[model samples]
Target: MTEGPPSILSLAWLLSLVYVFVAAVFVVRRLTDKSGKELARRIKAATRGRDAATDAAGDLVKRHEMSGLRWLDVFLSRQAWSRRMDKMLAQADIEAPLGIFVLLSLVLATTGYVAASLYAQNPFVRLAVGIGLGLLPFKWIAMRKARRMQEFERQLPEALELVGRALRAGHTFTSGMGMVVSEFAEPIRGEFQTTMEEINFGMGVAVALDNLMDRVDCPDLNFFVVSVKIQNETGGNLAEIVGNIAWLIRERLKLKGRIRVLSAEGRMAAWVLCLLPFFVCGAVQVLNPGYLNLLFTAPLGHILIYLVMGLMTMGILVIRKMVRIEV
Candidate 1:
């Protein structure tokens, strides 16, 4: 007897297997690529001590590509949004190419769409799942960027104090920055190192500092950059200025810590409030599977669901805004 036509579930599984195979091949190719190794070597060499003037005078110009794939990179280069995405990736300190992230998002979206199709009969639910999955990559990048910025902020005061000490010990500003680069850990070290490299690569101190500020998302870093710019124009004891800024940052951080401690209960309550509905819904689904079937099946229930989701989203945003005190 011949086999019957494959079901949607079987088709989905077939597609998932194909996707996994393609992803594995891509990963293997990426791992074994010679160009990636060459780029790594170049980056390592660039970070080593070298004659800045000679390197700056070299005819070699570095190309900033958005993606590893040439065609995708070319396409992304023409799009303004791609540049913003690239900046976000840089801020997140992700070494992966933009193409990889875009591809991952597409794969996730496709997978989610297929998976949702197996269970969710509603087209809107399937589309929502796909869109939500597509957004995951960007959400991850945003979270990473936020975490990195927080770490950078935490490291800023110590780095500033170190630079101030270096200045007081008769070192030049660039040398002081180099000291911070060598002494500290990432992402502050990486940021300062990039600033130093830019300065060395024929960029002016003020321009380099401005670029640094643009790259980093920390507000405390702005104080350091502004102070440096002001000191550069009108001569003052730079060491003392840096020290004062460092002290101010430390005090602000201390106040922020205290505020966080005080607001801990509110934050916890916000989390509980946000999660309680989902927990109840999940528990009900487990205890009485078809009890809430109307919510998914009926038009009025769908409208109510959407309205409730919107309100919940607004509430979450408001709660986040309330808890987040800018120091």
Candidate 2:
């Protein structure tokens, strides 16, 4: 039996919607794929080098391992984020920075607002919470990046010493770096390997070194770069200079570690103090919902809550700053 006209019309409408949905999915995938390819090209182009041929190709492959919305890259500086991003990117060898992260944050914020309006009993509060939650991923990414970079900085002197020994024993600077790249763990190995590869792709050694320092953006790395640059310019004993710098870095790392150990209790105390008030309020809400009804529903109560939140946020920042010991 032939289908009726209404059945045909309904089928046509359903097919149209399906086609539209499929088209959207394909377009999104195509765009993301194109963007990935472009980022890979940029990384390879920028990280070229001589003798080692270390391009961003390998690093780019590593970067794709992350969930793509790492919060750590947002709040941290390029120095910290680059190291963390490098780890994530290195896993997948992704050559791009965290541009996709920013996009994800905005999308999350939008999603939170929409979800809150549709499902939350109190839209404004839920929306605010959603935005805060959306910001959380970036913060996490930043912290991870900071910690990783700190670890790298702490170990940099040791790696430098290894390279210096190799250089003194008659290895070329490039070969010494290659040894470090192979022997040292990430992020030192990963970073040096990338630099070595870039240099191998025909970039000048000085420029490649500068690029590495730029990406690292650590004062420790900067010091090494300065020594290298000066040695190149004035014709000094490069290995000896690097060796001394390595010693200084080790001393600094030791001092910083001691300070961190001493300040551990204070840091822990600050975190607890900062979080206590929120914990109490959340408990009260759960135990006596009516007792806290005004906090969300009343205009005056909402304002007060915001004021309190602002103050709490400021207090946390102050405590964090007080506890932070810059080495």
Candidate 3:
């Protein structure tokens, strides 16, 4: 059964709801950024005769760390899931609460399920649609985190060079790390700041660096951490070591880029092959609804849809395998 376009009223209601949701988001962001604390801080500052600049300087240390426990942990019975979500959100630079993100996912999933249910008469299909839609927020965050990590990887060699230069200039290791924090941009800056904070709070250098590796999960960073740890124990020229590591990573990235360029044609062809069937089928359905309806009316048509989906999945996997080049 073909569904017609949504009614104007329904569209208008959706738009209004979206607007409300967006406004709520802004309100939440403002609260999260310590807006309420600002007044209290200002009054205290006035009493103590602290400067506005001092209050503003607090911005560097101020961040939205989830206070107390979340209800999600009660149902899940594990702090692990909450911690994982927090890590992913940090990696993606998302400045929202975990609960808020979960709520947003639920809303999107409900919307998608309703839309899918109109077209799909099957109960299983509706459930599947809801589940898939529910994962969209997580998928979006994961994609964002992946992109951020890639960007971090790109910035790393230069960041390493800066750190190495700082060390060569006779700075302490912590001071050199601080120089990276000041000189480079986030997420490198934020990451280093977090590490420095941990150190200032009495965490050992090795442990703090390990936490850094866990959060960033970059191979080049792994080298940095390991080299630093080994050097602290074994004693060596750390600046030259870091510089060499940075040079190696640059060469590796260059080779990876060359591989990507070489495989570009194959990747394009794969995309076309995967998408052409869907495009042709959609055009045919629009032009000749009756002709396309015959397939839907027949039991064999359902089987064909499943078969096509399976084939497409296999083809996509094969193409991915072909194009993937590890550096």
lDDT on C-alpha atoms for all candidate structures:
0.86, 0.72, 0.80
In the order shown, what is each candidate's alpha-carbon RMSD?
4.9, 10.4, 5.5
- Candidate 1 TM-score versus the reference: 0.82
Model 1 poorest 10 in a row by lDDT: 53-62
Residue 312, candidate 1: Cα error in Å is 1.8
lDDT of model 1, residue 246? 99
Q: Tell me each candidate's TM-score.
A: 0.82, 0.69, 0.80
lDDT of 1 by residue, 99-194 (tens): 777777888788889778867778889999999998999999999999999999999999999999999999999999999999999999998999
Report the candidate with higher TM-score, 1 versus 3. Answer: 1
Rank the models by TM-score, top first: 1, 3, 2
Clash-forming residue pairs, model 1: none
> 243 in model 3: Cα distance from truth in Å?
1.3
By lDDT, the better pick of 2 and 3 is 3
Q: Kindly list the per-residue Cα lDDT of model 3 for residues 74-189, writing each as its tens digit.
A: 44335677678878887888876676667667777776677677677777688888889888888998999999899889988998888889889999888888988988987888
